[model samples]
Target: MPTVKPRLSKQHQRWVMPTLVALVSGILMGLTVAPVEAWFLAWIALAPLWVLVLFPTQRLKLLIPLVWGIGYHGVALAWITGVHPMMWMGVPWLASIAIALFCWIAITLWGAVLVTTWAVCMTVFSRGVGTFTRVLIGVALWCGLESLWSLGPLYWSSLSYTQSPHNLVILHLGQISGSLAVTGAIVAVNGLLAEAWIRYQGSGIGNRGLGKSYKAAMRLFASSCLLFVALHLVGFGLYSRPLVQPPQAALKVGIIQGNIPNTIKLYPEGLRRAIAGYTEGYITLADRGVDAVLTPEGALPFMWSEALRTPLYSAVQQKGVTAWIGAFGEQGQSYTNSMFTLTGDGEFSRYDKVKLVPIGEYIPFEQILGGLIHRLSPLEAKQVPGSPDQVFDTPFGRAIAAICYSSAFPEQLRYQANQGGQFILSAANNAHYNPSMPAQHHAQDTMRAIESDRWAVRATNTGYSGIVDPHGKTLWISGLNTYELHAETIYRRTTQTLYVRWGDWLTPLLLGLAVVFKLTSIQASQK
Candidate 1:
């Protein structure tokens, strides 16, 4: 006898199409970001999502966006899984896998929560509004949420980054109001598309005469296309404007990519290898007559006092070239992830990392979850955060330092630049994760470079060491997992971009506009 397959319940059946549509939209949005980098898709990626949120038939409107966020973040952050196999960190194999999976899922859900929040706001604000008001509210809410998220712990996945390192025109908008302006433009275009499509569906085009709705839909679609072109044209004008560099000696900076394995980087054997490798690279670059040499974050993999005993210390003294090295620094009973600037004359300054990774550097709710799983850090003690006002005074010039995860925060770098930091020095250790992680990290650095209108010199363990010009172009970059040394000429410019002066001004303006529109809509309904 043949058995009948179990069917989904009526309630569950109602979710099938909406979930599929939301997922497709989310996946498209994810592809527009790094790794896949199908940036052209970003303009239309949100149309399906907008349609679902703008015209909801189901009672659970938030679920659509939550699922969409899961799909989007799941694809964008798939690289988080590369942290698995923490057996190197003394975690059991199965437990290590569970930890990695937990991190990925937890972060994804958190990101999804943000998306759902936006959906909730959009639904409330756009009710009883015309297409134009809907578009404005959509852009406002997106930019506002992105700005708010920047204030939170994690901020790697901003909408503006979708155009980075690929679409130079759109990226140029960052100079005006930082990445928020670019984000606004992106959401504006996507919102218009969604509005056009919604209007088209309601137009009933099969009628003999094209009704007002059909004409309105066509006009809206055309207006969106025009607005998209106009945004690009304005961006092109910004990109075309020449960035005049101050007349100063070009600093020849040498970058050392020490290919250290994360598993043994803290071990005695791995520590020895790191010392030898960086010492060799430092000496080689010094012999080449570089102004300074840079090593990846945690290149020494030990405390500052311990690093003093390594050959790298003696090498820096003998070589006489200024060196910016990443290592652990001790303060009282706490340790900090810091970047040390050592000049040939023995002058040294330290900038402790301001932003620490949530679970990787310090555990949240440590009182509750402390014993459950180990933090991803190699150090036993909790790492302390540095003052946000810290900037490195190097022999070359005042420089902004972004240590590892701190690179994702643009406002910190902008503040440093505003405080007379002429250039950016980003040191990272991407040895633990896959190539995608470093690439995404590199993209973020490029965005910061463009926004600040400063040259950025980046050094990383294992690969992607490079220099980016003020225009967000990669002047030099290295291959993944390769031990390489490169030197490039980067300028120290004192000219501050508009973004450096204003600092995310557009975010608040957009949010305020959203509030005004919502209030107006409610007032109109009452009348």
Candidate 2:
């Protein structure tokens, strides 16, 4: 008797294969970011999911993108577990494990929901649309969703970040079109590949249309190749434009990292050590002939009044170099994470942090849910958010400063740039997070530098501090968990990039167009 082969049922074909493909696709997409950083993979990462949506199946298309979002976010955001883990927050061990898992899963699911919603919307809108139209819809929907998320409080990662600050050549695309342009280009390529794939497979299987399918596949493939080449060429043109910084007027800035361990960062004894550590670090840099010394966030580890009363203020006053210090500033019942600038003649200016990290710095809707969250976690002492429009007037130049979490929002920085921010200044306390967090955070700042066309001086406590030029190249970067000072002369440019001028106006416009197209497609289908 001949061996008999069992055929796959409709349910297995529709559900099992699509689900597995979506899962694998999401994982690969996630790998294109930090901890793995296989950026080239981003070109093809969405192909599997894109292909899945092309064919007919009883399987819910919504579930395909949902699984992808879960995979990508689950891996990309794994470091969330390390951010003030439940045990560190004084919860019981078993409960701590459960809490950490819950937090991670919650964040992953939230991101997944946003992504899956986009997929569903795209599927509905893309009915009867050609491959090219589908690609445009995908790009528009993705950009629109990112813009929507950015308008909210929890803006973290974007698809363009997958390319990273390392890919200097292509990253210049950000200067012209911002991160959305890079993301759109990547999606378009994925769509092209998916279209080519469907057609090619149909030809191979000879499903009653071999000749036509092969020709269509060849055209799509050729178009994808042409687009790939054209994008790189455009990138090269943008990259070739020199960002001319005034070499003669370059500010010699010094940065310090105190290497404070997270275990003792906020304790009484640790606060004393932090003051001493940063004082010494500041003196060390001032002695090295720096024109200005920049310190990390919470370097003083005390209230503004106490910081002024300390010997460190006298040291800075005597050193005669401009000093920008990050410390806690208090006003009555409110506390702000502020950056204070002390000139040689004792003139002072302060820029408070506007964007507070939810649940970490300040709990949202604390009036209603504060009591409940307090019982669940020991989070107390909320840091009040500062004015979004404050700019620091430094002796070196008029600068804009983003403290820690504020760096994640590009529009805030763009607004500052529009307000005559010569060069960007960022100070951070990354002492409590994992190494991966800082790397990813640092990458976000790099995009800001490129987007605004300004030199960025980033000072962080306990790692990944560096000077990024207007071109988004890391001129100098410090190692993680190390105490050190980097002294370099950074060029301050006044020129603004396209992103700074128009901001993200293009994305919202595209989003509106997407809605119109979707509604029109539905109407046409009915007709």
Candidate 3:
């Protein structure tokens, strides 16, 4: 005999298809997000998972979905690994790697849990339901889970963002119901494909039923294709509507990108560079007759008190134009990551950053893990969070201020928009990670701009400073790791998009309908 090969056991054989489907689906979904931007893949990325749900043979359904979650989040959030080699934080080489890996793994697992929960709900609650009912349940479950996760400690990489800044038509759907509406459309299309796949497979079974089943499957496939086009049509209609501009002077805002390395951002040399770079950019923009200027988050990298004594502060005072500069603000005994505005009239106002990063900003479960790791954040002290209901009142207009991580939360920004925020000022420091993080962060800002129907001005450290119009169009964008200054005229509109007024209303409605559908299906089965 040439060779003796062992065949896979029945149990292993059963798991083979599910495992492959789960991984393929997850990875494709991940690639649909930013940096890769294979948005077209998202339409069919979830179809395999839905098919697996409709015809599950694996003993552990949750295991497959959990693996799917891991695959998706691992790829989408791979930028989190860029935090490694944090020797600049005084962490030992191996310890720094360990911390970065820990953060990446922990968050990936958490995100995976959401996917697993949705899969389990669909498998359990959608049994014996018709194809249409099952799809309704699937869409509801997915949107509901997205909404729930958004309210939690970490929220990024929503399904809605898959279309952002690329598929302007689908992205426009966000104006109606935030990201949930876009997500619902995506899930609905995937579910229809899965239903068609199931019917096609059934067509191969009995000879007598073959033609009818095949025709039905073909009809469903065509219907799905039509529905996809119809959704795009609706989105285009929404996108075509012109935004009502307020009858006021356009505010010309300048953004300064100080390309400072995160490793040395706190060092004496780094601080000197920060001051010089921003001061130079600020003065240049001021000379250009810009109404206001915005600096990236932590552009000063020092306390507000210390910043006031710096040359940058002196430059802003002399320029006599409002400057929104990012620095640390004092709060009782702790400090706050804040955006401080130096008004033209020499008055000062500050908007402290809420939604601090869990371990990176402040160690969570400090009573347990405090002593285990020396420090993950480069900051010398733990920072206090600001109130969520804050807005920046500037000479130009009242603007929503989202400092770095806060940009990921849509409802938070929507509430600020409802509170009379005319535009969005997004300040970020992306020096810690690679260009992917900045790109993703910029995408989030774009979504916020569309949902609130407000122009968004983004200033970032070490790259991707730009301006976006109300319709998710980038007016101007800077290159990564560049020291640049850009000024663009953006309007301040008082009209709020429907999303701003409703604020995630679709999520609750979907969840409630899912419950009713599930109960009705169960009752019908019993009868």
Over 1-527, each residue of candidate 1 has an lDDT whose tens digit, in order, gives 13333345554556887788899889988898768989888888877888888765655588899988988888888888888988878888998898889889988998898889999999887888767878888888888888789888887877788787899888888888998898888888888887777777787859415677777777888988999999899888878888675557489999999988898888888888899999999999999988999999999988998888888889989878899999999988999999999876774799999999888888888887677676476778778899988878887779989998888888899999999998999999887787878888888899999889889999998878889998888989999988899998888888887899988888788778777877888888899
Extract clashing residue pairs from model 1: none
In model 3, the runs with Cα more than 4 Å from the true position are 1-12, 205-210, 244-247
Q: Which runs of model 1 end up more than 4 angstroms from their true locations?
A: 1-13, 56-58
- Count clashing pairs, candidate 3: 0
Tens digits of lDDT, candidate 3, 298-395: 99988888988888888877879889999999888889999988975664678999899888888888888887564665566778899988877877
Per-candidate TM-scores read 0.95, 0.92, 0.96
lDDT of candidate 2 over 47-85, digit per residue (tens): 787888666543577888889899888887787777544
Identify the superior model by TM-score, candidate 1 or candidate 2: 1
Considering only N, C-alpha and C atoms within 3 Å, which residue pairs clash in candidate 2?
none
Off by over 4 Å in 2: 1-10, 84-89, 207-210, 365-380, 512-527
Residue 347, model 2: lDDT of 43
